[model samples]
Target: MTDETSARIAPPLTDLPIAVSERGFYSGFSKHVTIPSKIIISLLIVWAIAFPVNAGEVLGIANTTIIRLFSGWYVWLVGGFLVLSIILAALPASGKLRLGRAGDVPEFSRFSWFAMMFGAGLGIGMLTYSTGEPLSHLQNNPVIIAGEATALTENAVRSAYVYSFLHWGFSAWAIYALVGLAIGYVAYRRGLPLTIRSGLAPLLGHRLSGMSGHAVDIVAVVATILGISVTLGLGVEQFVQGLNRIGMGDWLLAKDNSASIPAIVLALMIIVGASTLSALSGVGKGIKWLSNLNLVLSFILFAAFLIAGSALFSLEIFARGLLDYVTALPALSFITNAPDGTTIGDGIAQWQLDWTVFYWAWWIAFAPFVGMFIARVSKGRTVREYILGVVIAPALMCFVWLSLVGGTAVELVLSGAGEGNIVGTVLSDQLYATIAALMDSGLAYAFSVLVVLLLLTYVITSADSAILVVNTINAGGNDSDHGRRHIMFWGVAIALVVGSLLLVGGLDAIRTAMIIGALPFSFVSALLAVAVVKAIWRDTIRLRHGIECTVPPEAKADPAS
Candidate 1:
């Protein structure tokens, strides 16, 4: 499984030595553990006990701490560090991040690869939140247009979509592209395995070699699991809530909090079972099919919403949304003010932080895993092409989706169609229901089912990707995908952990756990910035001392930064 051509040890990018043996151990584990079936069974058992017993005050403290310490400030910390990382990726030394030249196009078409990576990485969040959040924001936006103006107006509708775009668009994807460019360069070009700890490899040099590397791998494995689990937990809640709205009803909510354990276990089983199956299908066959299917279903749902809902009003809202979004982009970019009302002008500043900075932070906590997944599938593309695809491509898709779905929802409510009070009744429960309500017959019912399936598929795709990334961390990127048994082990284990935590705490509790998990990765991200910059600066000095650089950076490459 070794190739001399790919044998150059990825230049240690951290202050630690490359723990070759430790990495090899985890890599071996990844190659050996792939059992989808066992993963499900074990997930059920663990979920049975994680709840009922652990649901109490400690978790309460965790929730309060999360809101105070991480929730409010996360955007600033994550966003600030992200800008710093992008600047590092812009240097000529960043050419190292380039993978093998668009070498012999692979079997999958470029678009297919992009679809799988994109769907697996972020599609889950988009599907669950797109329609609902924008509507909610529109119902409340008074600060944007008239600067503390009246109630919801035409401009309020516009401002709503602007915030949705802010949450899902360019500012969000920037985190992924920047991280991918840094880690992918080391892995693809310099031959390092794809692992989060390696993001700091350039500065560490050979130091990542022993216990230190193991520490990095373990922390990454834990953080990634918690982070991905938070998303998966949310996915299960949304799916159940969506199903309930369609036909399933509230029994799924559990009679007693103790009964909630089985619900979580069942969800974990579905997620782990599907993902393990997809993982076994290998990255291309199973994952690609699922991802392509997800994209098609998503498009179909968008079409259904537009055609069935009020089209004209949606269009007007979309146009205005874009204008307000553009005008307010600078304000949302990074400004922050505490909600305490310390300064008169500070209230204005806090709005930007609440929306813009919060998203930026969410994406930062999100970028490591998503960036790794994107870079993993992005080989054999030019540096410029990769950055553009990863950043611009996804942002455009999100914007279009928001315009259609979010715009349609607001129009439906405003124009007095089915439910103007839809936001108050069940914003979380009915986003998908509204989609079904638009269509009039068995066809709508069928489409709703398809939406559920697609949601499940993307959920599995995301979990599978998370499983692989964690394995990579555990194995130190020994290059192999590990054994089916091993992969399944973690898959089930993660499902159990997520399900258990969900039972013990619920979505809010799991969210608190995630922000807690993010504390470490957030620091890792900061270190990644420092290491990348140090390496880039050192190489820049070396390059200057050597040949007269033929093409200036701005000329040879189109930098996203």
Candidate 2:
């Protein structure tokens, strides 16, 4: 069980040969990663800002093409990740494998860990989509389009949540858990650096230490940036809408009632600036505090909905939705539709492209940042615990939020309390309209203010965590405080990306770019699934040989022994 014996029995886990700058502002940064990622992203920002129409057009064409070609790939690949994650966790041997050294304990409390995981993973989406998505699907989904259910009815509610849970449920988290588990196993158990390339080391071996590895890291960096940009863009839109609802007037929005360019710029200035400061404070202090505050505010908002909104109806929806989601998960996960030149088929196909395919791409693009953040905070947990926490726990929370928050919207619309406003409002305005329908003017205004604060915290937490993750990749997984300038650099880069994309084509442009960027990383994620399985299988063989698999070679021997 000694480290030396284990080292001799197991295949070598080599260190990545990434070059780090030793001096100047880029000190401790990997030139291979930082320079290329910055250049690519900077060029994108400039292009989007300089030629807005052309950039939007190109992005639109590229997004359409990629989605058309790869929609099935995105669905099946993500479903495979869920199956793989469950298999890995269900196996007795792999499930017991620890993510860190033998004596290492968890770095954060369970509450703090879950808070950060949930906050970093889906907090912004919960605020933006919990109400909007279910309401949208209630109006039109495959079930409604196929005549299986009437729009805005009870059966339609079931259909709505089935799709809602499909997007935000286990499959989405599995994508994140797979990457996090892969990187955590390699980085913690094998003593590799905590970077995307390190997760593939088990399969690619030493080849990953060169340009191939650098390329993987760069792709991950770009994906992370775009993913964060899309999230921030959506969050800013909702934030501006909240401001308008809370008496900021129509001036905060443009003629089309979307967030104006000036509003987006101002919001990003406040958000990214605060996020940069939080990134400097690191995950332990500022990020954790913000995440905790986010949860508190979230609970308050949820309580308001439960009390003043449709509590009994939402509870019923939650119960039935959970059942329907579980019953339909398999079909929802693997099934894809192609336009057959028929009405229902085309509607189904387009729905998949808009909702399901878009969500899969978003999750894939987000995996690097969220996965790395989860791995960073999940050092000492077992594979089963990690899966349960990353995949199961947060997903249950999402179901509740969708049911309660979204169910309230549905009930108001159905009961005529909303006077057609909730369903008729835009996505960003839907949450505010729901609040207005739930309470009187004074209470609704106050509630809107609380929601705005919650949105701000969620946005800040997501932005700061993503900045840290990008910096970690660029630093070759150093995870040290030697990259303050790099942190600020990424923070600014993300702001410019979000700002420019928002100005040109709003959330649509950012979504297009994210889907396109996610394509490359989807392949990388598939490799991660393979690598982790290979690693665990090989380590199982070693375990059968009486070789210790958890402890790395550098852990010191017991002095008494």
Candidate 3:
């Protein structure tokens, strides 16, 4: 076919209409999405607050049942997402398709883009898990339980990193990348609203304009709230602990060393208040500034570990651990341990649930917030660039973090530098404990302050970015500024969810709620995988027929229209 003929036959990129309130409290918002999401989240908050013990018990039971029933599904779905992301990026036709019109240029600099992406996607997680995960896996993993390696020994270090890298590596980022790619392609190229349902446009077509679409977005909003709540909950624990370490007094923590209700309340107020203010400032200014600051702070922290805490050992671990992780990735990605009524089988099953399954759910739950944020900032990039930027680059950065920070913790335990203090402490305390072991009292306190500052930025960045994402979805993918009131509303709502759940059962309660919330979204994510592939396949056919795959500038529909 000739170019003119192909152009004539090319599909039109029409705007998908989404209802938004022009008046009332929800003015400029999609009442269909916003009202239901708010009601659902508000109900959960009231439940946790009114009946803390019962809320925790119900959440725990629901989490257990969901994990038992869907563990393999989570495993295979996540693994398949990774494979699908790679395939889409690797194909010549699909890889070259731009997210926006041919004349469009990227809005952010490469460095700024990466900074925001990493900060929103996994910055808090890197801080929370870098040391804790490696140390925990050092004590126990499936390989350790299987008797292939002994825990707390040199022989087990590889297995520790293998699992650590597994949880934090490519597979995790693949979930985020696929979600972003799907939504970005549909919204940018096809002129659809930049919401979760738009990602399935290729499969759902006009059905996305109705209640079915609202359901998809509601699932996304709930999952995003719960997902970010888990991060905030964990960060609050560490934030409170950091305060205690810096001489804030024993009143901040309970007899068990966990943050008390008062401490949790105080931390939430500070974090959510700051985050709401940042959200009002919008992404380009507040979010970008915080992301860059956190990246620099993260570099400084990593450098300290390199200089003071077993640099050579960490470098060795980086090299070997990365190799082991890469070599075992395929198997690790697909591995599912079903209970066979044997002790070992049950042990492995529980271990998988605690570690791998939980991490998958966490990442999946997190995908909508991070993915939408990424898609917003990542216009005008190719499929190949998007995948490489989103998946490969951050995964490499995570590996470096695991090597330097986590590796140092492992070295300390092996060499007796920590004298069991690091391993003996809670996950939130491990980072502080490691720093104390590495330096004198004064320097350690100074370093702990820096760590706390970094944590604060990460928490604010995640929370604020999430608030923007939720607003974006609620407004039916409207990227324009929502009034400050809406931003504050979400910030306060998220604080309530995190605070009430933390009061109920600490981080465990928050985690259980997040996992349960992530379940429905997991199925939605699976559909997203299929939708993206179908869209790309059809686009490739257009490319082969001499038709432009991207919507032309003049043909593109305005979402507001």
User: What's the TM-score of every candidate structure?
Assistant: 0.81, 0.96, 0.96
lDDT by residue for model 2 over 1-561, one digit each (tens)? 798765546654645566788988788888888899999999999999899999989999999899999999999999899888889889999999889878888999999998999889899889889899999899899999999999987778888888998899999999999999999988888777889999998778777778999999999999999999989988999999999999887789998889987788889999999999999999899999999999989999998888887889889988988998888988888998999999999999998999999999999999999999999999989999999889999999999999899989998888888999988878988999999988899999999999999999999999999999999998888887638878888889999999899888889999999998999999999999999898888787777897666647365322110
Identify the runs in model 1 with alpha carbons over 4 angstroms from their true place.
1-27, 30-56, 70-73, 77-97, 101-108, 141-153, 245-250, 254-263, 341-361, 534-561
Candidate 3, residue 536: how far the Cα is off, in Å: 1.7
Candidate 3 stretches greater than 4 Å from native:
1-13, 552-561
lDDT of 3 by residue, 1-561 (tens): 688765444563455677888998888888899999999999999999999888988998899999999999999999998898888889888899888878777899999999999998888888888899999999999888889889899999999998998998899999999999889988888778889988988888777889999999999999999999999998899999999999998899998999988998999999999999989999989999999999999999988988898888888988999999889989988989988898888898899999999999999999999999999999999999999999999999999999889888898899899999999999999999999998999999999999999999999999999999999999999868566788889999999999989889989999999999999999999888888887777777666776666764346432311
lDDT of 1 at 533: 59
lDDT of each: 0.62, 0.89, 0.90
Expressed as tens digits, the lDDT of each residue in 1-561 for candidate 1 is: 245422222222322224433353333543222222234335433544554445445556755555446554566555554355445435445544335333423346777877876786688777767777777677654355336533345656656777787777665776677676666655654455677656666656555555555555555566567677777877787677656655865666665312245455676788889888777666667777888888888878777766776677667766776677767766665555455555435554445534454444456656667777776777666555666677668877887777777666666666666455456455445566566546675876777687778778889888887777665665566536545766777787777767767766676656656555566666666666566555445444434455221222123211111
TM-score for candidate 2, please give it.
0.96
At residue 53, give the lDDT of candidate 3.
81
The lDDT, on a scale of 0 to 1, for candidate 3 is 0.90
Superposed by TM-score, candidate 3 places the C-alpha of residue 87 at a distance from the truth, in angstroms, of 1.0
- On a 0 to 1 TM-score scale, where does candidate 3 land against the true structure? 0.96
lDDT assessment of candidate 1 = 0.62
